[model samples]
Target: MTLILAHRGYSAEYPENTMLAFREAAKAGADGLELDVQMTKDGELVVIHDEKVDRTTDGTGFVKDYQLKDLLKLDARFKFASLPNREPIPLLKEVLEWLAGTDLICNIELKNTLFMYEGMEEKVIEMVREFRLTDRIIISSFNHYSIVKSYMLAPEIEIAPLLSDGLYMPWIYAQSIRAKGFHPHWRAAQDEIVISSLDSGVEVRPYTVNKDNELERFFRVNCSAVITDDPVNARLIREKTKQA
Candidate 1:
């Protein structure tokens, strides 16, 4: 069966990357969670998508400029004004600690492609090791170099490259980087590509898959997983596909 991973933790209905979102995603029966991680000025790992806080939070500057304490002050609920309480940016440590108690898999996308957060991989790996959740964690990045560095630091944990555009024989490219999986944009995950890659032992899990037809397609095809903002809808579609 294809796994349903909540993209940014059931972000369709809740403020993304917030504890509320993750908890709700688990309650909705998602198999996993996909989230982004970036480093703060104080060298703390934070769970947010962008290099800057302008888009997601009430803050206006780069995430790298703020100390963890200062960063936590910005409400992550900027996009969802209807939400009542302030949603603070969560620390990687806090998320990992929470994840330790669950059976859900986590795909932690290192947000270092733009700013190159020095030592971010090491810090993330160390934290995962500390939490003893290495087996259930997957480190992914659009920066192939960052993915390679993470693989070197902890080969026991799975690592994958995030692709926005299609790559020729991505499984081969993944093998070159020693990546155990591939997370591609939905369009990049062609049927032949998915089948061939999985046959080659490279797991393929596409991102941001939300449409009912698309969700059912991935489920029927048996790709490793589908990362979507609406895991609840995705889970429902998966059941329908199974019944068919």
Candidate 2:
């Protein structure tokens, strides 16, 4: 089966990265959940997409400038703009605690590519150990070094490298870093790239591939997973394909 990992939780319906979003994704039957994490001024791991709180929240500053407590006060759902209720920025610990009771896998993308968060690897690994969810978590990042450091910190945990463009013979470099999988953008789902990566024993899961045609292409090529905002639709497509 091509795993359906909800991108930013069921973001098409809920405020991205909120508890409500994650719960909705699980309810929609996503195999796993994918979310972004950045460190706050107080060194707290916050589950928001942007380096700055300006896009997703009502706040007007960099995430690194505010503590988690202050970030909590900001309206994270404001960008959704029409919702009457607001969700606060959640901590990584809170999310990990939530995952401990469920069978869902977590693809935690470290949002430190632009603004490096020192000690992020240790903090995340510590949380996974605390929850005993080392097996269920997949640490992913665009920052190759962070993923490498995460692999070094916990060789037991699976690491997936996130890339925007398709790498030429990606498995070579992926193997060099001991990455267990590749989390490339939807554009990287070219047949040759997908086949070569799989042939190298690396699982490929492309991001934001919500459309039916693209979903079909990935499934046809036997990619391991598709990270999407519309898990409901993706699941339906997977089922429909099975019957066809």
Candidate 3:
């Protein structure tokens, strides 16, 4: 059965990457959570999607411009007028603390491809080790080098390469890097792709799949996991389809 990982923490109902979203995602019975991580100017790891805070927060400018203390003042749910309580941007440490109490897995995406925050891999690995969540965490990144560095830092921790478009022989590419999993885009994760990844001793988990039909297709192929915005619906379909 494909594990349902909530993309940016049940983002369909709550603000993406916010603590509220993560809590809601876990409450909805998601097997795992997928989120982005970036470093603040003061060297704190924050949970957010974009390289800048302009899209999601009330603040302007890049996320790296401000210290963690100043960054906390910005409203993460500034655009969500419907959500009564505005959520503050959470630190990676805070999120890890919460996950320490739960059995749910966390896929921490290192958003360093654009900004290329130096020593981010070291910081993230340090946090994971401090929390003793080596088994529960999956470090994924579009910046393959960051994932590679993470693997070098801690071989025991799982690292997955996040590919947006179809990479040629992704399973082989993952194996070349000694990655434990391949995080592919949903459309690119066809039956053959999934099969090859699994057969090569690599796991294939596609991202951002929300529709029922697409979810059903991935589940039918028995992919390792499906990262979706609607984990509740995915969970329901998995239970219904798997039993049939």
lDDT by residue for model 2 over 1-244, one digit each (tens)?
8999999999999999998899999999999999999999999998999888888888898999997789899988855878877889899899999989889999999988788889999999999999999898999999989999999999999999999996888888788899978898999769788888898898899999988988988887788999999999999888877777
lDDT of 2: 0.90
Global lDDT of each candidate = 0.93, 0.90, 0.92
Cα lDDT of model 1 overall? 0.93
Better of 2 and 3 by lDDT: 3
lDDT for each residue of candidate 1 in 1-244, tens digit (9 for 90 to 100): 8999999999999989988899999999999999999899999999999999998998989999999999999999877888888899999899999999999999999998789999999999999999999899999998989889889889999999999999999999999999988999999998999999999999999998998888888888899999999999998899999999
Ranking by lDDT: 1, 3, 2
Deviation from native of the Cα of residue 202 in model 1, angstroms: 1.2
- What are the runs in model 1 whose C-alpha is more than 4 Å off? none
Q: How far is candidate 1 from the true structure (C-alpha RMSD, Å)?
A: 0.8
Candidate 3 Cα RMSD after full superposition onto the native fold (Å): 1.0
TM-scores across all candidates? 0.98, 0.97, 0.97
Clash count (model 2, backbone only): 0
After superposition, the stretches of candidate 2 with alpha carbons farther than 4 Å from their true spots are none
Each prediction's number of clashing residue pairs = 0, 0, 0
Better candidate number, 1 or 2, judged by lDDT = 1
* Best model per TM-score: 1
